[model samples]
Target: MTLNNDYFKARLEELREELLAELAVAGPHPESGHGYSTHPADHGTDAFEQTAGIAVRRNAERLLYEVERALTRIEENRYGICRDCGQLIDRARLKVIPYARYCLDCANKHSKG
Candidate 1:
């Protein structure tokens, strides 16, 4: 089945915008150090929350990188094709993960390796 590049592009673009907005909102705002209480428990809680926030931000950054790469592939006319095997990616997979770069077989192989 043929995939609709325009649809995928639009979806990816929307995701990219959302991610950017999320990052902007999350960035430049380190509540951990701001108005932190002097209590021992408050310190511990703040530290844990800071760590969790860092983890979440890192994950968002990684996903943004992947999404940007997928957008580049789309621009280059290489989207929906497996990078390793050069085969068309499955339509169902694309529908689920519009930024996928590998077919199911290739993805499975890579995961195993």
Candidate 2:
């Protein structure tokens, strides 16, 4: 089956914009309050913020990597082919996850194994 470069290109651009927005939110900032004398509640909230920010940044970085890979695939003319099976990945799956490198069957098998 033929790969749809226009469709995947649009999807990749959307994902890139989303990751950039999330990364902007996750960027570091100075501490809100004075150091080492904050209340317990404030400290707890700070810890939660730090953890959440790290998680968001990590996910954003991963998404950015996937988006880059998708763009590379488009350049290589291999965008919708499953890497493992050399078959066309389903359009439905691509619509839902444009960065997917494997078709559903291979992905499911890989997950189980």
Candidate 3:
């Protein structure tokens, strides 16, 4: 069965908003030194937090990139097609990962090679 564009679009929009909110809360600017701490223990805690914040930002950015690509595919009438194999992606997989670019087989093969 074909996946619904409206459903995927709504899901992508929700994800985009969630990522934006996360980035906002995480202080979006790591190089500004906005949350420095002076105490030794506090410094360690601050360092850990900074590292975690950078990871969170990177994850959000990656997901945002995929979501944008999916949205573009929706607009271009190319949603649900595997980028590598030019085949229809499974509806179940799409439901689980709306921004997926490759089908399961191709994804596995590409990952292994």
Candidate 4:
């Protein structure tokens, strides 16, 4: 069955908005020293937090990139087609992850490497 275009658009848009909000609050900009701890003793804690925060930001950015790519695919009339296998993606999978670029089989194969 064909997936619902309206639902795909809305779901992706919602996710994009959420990721943007999360990025805005993503912890300290160490370069700018905006959220870093001032005390020397707290440097260790701050470093850990900074590392974790950078990871969080990177993950959110990756997700946001995928979401945007999906949106672009939709506009190009290529959404729901697996990038590797060129198969139509499962409707249920699309419902759960609107930004998915691979079908289950292709995704599984890719993940194995």
Winner by lDDT: 3
For each candidate, give its TM-score against the true structure.
0.78, 0.79, 0.85, 0.80
TM-score of 2: 0.79
lDDT of 3 at 31: 56
Instruction: Give every collision pair in model 2.
Output: none
TM-score of 3: 0.85
User: Higher TM-score: candidate 1 or 2?
Assistant: 2
Clash number for each model: 0, 0, 0, 0
lDDT of 4 by residue, 1-113 (tens): 44587789889999999998877766446445565444344445465676776777889999999999999999999999999989999989999889999999989999998
User: Where is the poorest 10-residue window by lDDT in model 1?
Assistant: 35-44
lDDT of each: 0.79, 0.80, 0.84, 0.83
The predicted structure with the larger lDDT, 1 or 3, is 3
lDDT of candidate 1 over 1-113, digit per residue (tens): 44588888888999889888766645545454553343335344456776675676777788899889999998998899999999999989988988888999999999999
* Poorest 10 consecutive residues by lDDT, candidate 4: 36-45
Worst ten in a row by lDDT for model 2: 30-39
User: Which lDDT tens digits does candidate 3 get at residues 1-113?
Assistant: 44699889988899999999877766646656763443234344466787887888889989999999999999999999999999999989999999999999999999999
Better of 1 and 3 by TM-score: 3
Score residue 99 of candidate 3 by CA lDDT. 95
